[model samples]
Target: MNRLKPFYEITVKLAELLDQDINAKNRETIISQVNLLIEKRGDLLPEVPPPFTEDEKRVGSDIVLLNNKIQQKMNALFIDLKREMKQFKKQKKSNKTYTNPYEKIQTMDGMFLDNKK
Candidate 1:
């Protein structure tokens, strides 16, 4: 009971962090914090604990929902990245074509004679 308070607090913090629109550096910080909390929780898991209270159960569900939101955000970012990459490739190809418009033309071999000989 007393020991679980810290764990619940950390879990709530993690959920709040995930819900925010944080930058990469802040996100890394949050990840490190979560990792530390996970390690600490892992060591404590062997001890038999009482059932979760209503509030604790609600916080757990909130964490799950936050994690899902984070996953969706990442998926959207990946999709946007792929779309931008495709646009970049198309632009590059168009630039190459513009710069080398005659690249497809085949050159004919011609003999050069020494007219001054």
Candidate 2:
């Protein structure tokens, strides 16, 4: 377990680094820190991080669930946008339209006459 301590702490730090959105400067800092840790650990890298227990193995990371949630949100947003566009198009068509019902027109005696009359 002593050997695993360094990796555990490193994993925690990595998680922290990834959790907060950072700009280039902060990203470079975290990456450099990781590289330094790796150099310090040297050949002991594989031994440093022990495998998770059975429980952890069973539960697994929540990353997949989080990813699915994000995907669902994106899909819903796309569907809503498409629905809105469809409604907007329908409104546009309804708003500007010609409902012309030319009942009848007769050209008789060189004059136009309304046949409906």
Candidate 3:
């Protein structure tokens, strides 16, 4: 049995999970699973030793490709998360302003008006 087999399978599974469309409902579960897979991947890394066979080398190369795909997916997800956060902040500010339009207004800023009698 190839030592890298488990690692390769994990990477492939990670890639698949990252490829799924994330919405509000399953977002938390998917993220948790992704984190678990990442930890597992880390734990499995040190177990595999050197002196690679041809099949093992092939699996190793496949794992590299999968890693690249996974990195790209993660980057895309990060960008999307940033965009959503910005939108949420904007929405919150808008809601606040809608609720109290005078909240941000400055009144009587140390200016006095004089009138001639």
In terms of lDDT, which candidate is strongest?
3
The residue-by-residue lDDT of candidate 1 on 44-91, one tens digit each, is 665526587877676667656665765675566457557877999999
Per-residue CA lDDT of model 2 for 45-106, tens digit only, reads 66634476654433334433443553554455457557877999998766655343332443
The TM-scores, one per candidate, come to: 0.48, 0.35, 0.86
**What is the model-wide C-alpha lDDT for candidate 3?**
0.89
Per-model clash counts, in order, read: 0, 0, 0
Best by TM-score: 3
Q: Give the TM-score of candidate 2.
A: 0.35
Judged by lDDT against the true structure, how good is candidate 2? 0.52
Kindly list the per-residue Cα lDDT of model 3 for residues 25-109, writing each as its tens digit. Answer: 7877988999999999999999998888888988888889989999998888778778989999999999999999999877688
In candidate 3, list every pair of residues with a backbone clash: none
Output the worst ten-in-a-row residue range by lDDT, candidate 3: 106-115
Give RMSD (Å) of candidate 3 vs. truth: 3.8
RMSD of each: 9.1, 14.0, 3.8
Q: Which has the higher TM-score value, candidate number 1 or candidate number 2?
A: 1
lDDT of each: 0.65, 0.52, 0.89
- Candidate 1 has a TM-score of 0.48
Reference-based lDDT, residue 77, model 3: 78
